[model samples]
Target: MTAEVCEIVITAPDAEWAADFTRTLVETRLAACGHQTPIRSIYRWDGAVHDNAETRIALHTQLIHADEILRLTNQSHPYKVPCFLVQPILSASPDYGTWIIDCTTRPEAI
Candidate 1:
């Protein structure tokens, strides 16, 4: 049976933050690919409604790496609470799915 691929989405304060975090994840083989973009966010914080600019990072990886991704992001992100959301990619082309698995596969321990 094929394993599921996940697209882990995170929102950050700016483009630099998104890109840097993405780089760390990819370098460690925690994610296969990452895309980033600027986004406007509207939400309540500290009991006040606020609108702000944010950067969104979408990372493609196998489902098995989700926890490590979240743990690393939580440790590295500047926000009191970073936006880390995971969505299962249920219909990827067979080749793309295999690619995700291949890139994100955990390295064997010595």
Candidate 2:
């Protein structure tokens, strides 16, 4: 692995779903923290263009555990084709970056 940390971006149908999933991810150490926002999404699906309101989540986690995070998201996310985008954290404050790595190293059941 090139780095020890990564950010996983995902979209949820609503705030409730994003919040619930964020809680689970944090508790299970799949993610150290999550940022959620309400967003307007316009996309083409099944040969039709659609516009909808959605929740976007940015999850911070250790690179080593990214696959497990995807596993959990795939299992619980409501979307038939959930978007799970993984981006390497190229730069961050040393202390902040360390904290993220530390927080996600320890796991707990919720």
Candidate 3:
């Protein structure tokens, strides 16, 4: 069966949390690579509009492993409602794409 590439974006309250979460994900082989960027988010929550600065972690993983990845992320996340957005990769550099697929595949040690 052909493998699919996917990117998932998760937001954390701060950079420290983002780093910790991303490290766990990579160490567990749930993600191939994770990039964290600082961002300012403005949204309504509990009937109040608010603005806050947050860190966003984008995870590169495989489609087949999406559910497990999300499950683990939510379990470890600090927010009551963590943001987990998944996007399919339409196309990518062949070598990098292959690497993403290889990294997310089931490991022999697991």
Candidate 4:
């Protein structure tokens, strides 16, 4: 089967949650790499506009594992309404793409 790459972005309330979430994802092989960046988000919540600085984790994984990744994120996420966004990878370096596939693939002798 051909491998498909994807990027999943999830926002956390703080740095700690971002760190914990990234660790869990990597340990479970749901993601190959996760990058956390601080972001200032302004959005409407409950008819009121709110602005806050948040940490966003960008998870690099295969499309085949997206459902499981989303499920686990929602299950363990701290936010009442977490942001889970999936973006397809249009292009990437050949080596990095191969690495993502290798890291996210199911183990053969498992």
Which residue segments of model 2 deviate by more than 4 Å? 107-110
Cα lDDT tens digits, model 3, 15-99, are: 9988988888788788899999999999889999989999999999888778987898778888889899999988888998989
Candidates in order, TM-scores: namely 0.92, 0.92, 0.92, 0.92
**Candidate 1's error at 100, in angstroms?**
0.9
Candidate 1 lDDT, 49-97, residue by residue in tens: 9899999999999787899888888898999998999998868888888
In model 3, the worst 10-residue window by lDDT is 101-110
Full-model lDDT, candidate 2: 0.88
Per-residue lDDT over 1-110 for candidate 2, one digit per residue giving the tens place of the 0 to 100 score: 22888999999999999999999989877788999989999988889998999999999888888888889888998988888999999888888898898788874422
Model 4 C-alpha lDDT per residue in residues 1-110, reported as the tens digit of each score: 12499999999889998998899888878899999999999999999999999999999999988899889888989887899999999889899999998887778624
Cα-based lDDT for every prediction:
0.87, 0.88, 0.86, 0.88
Better of 1 and 3 by TM-score: 1
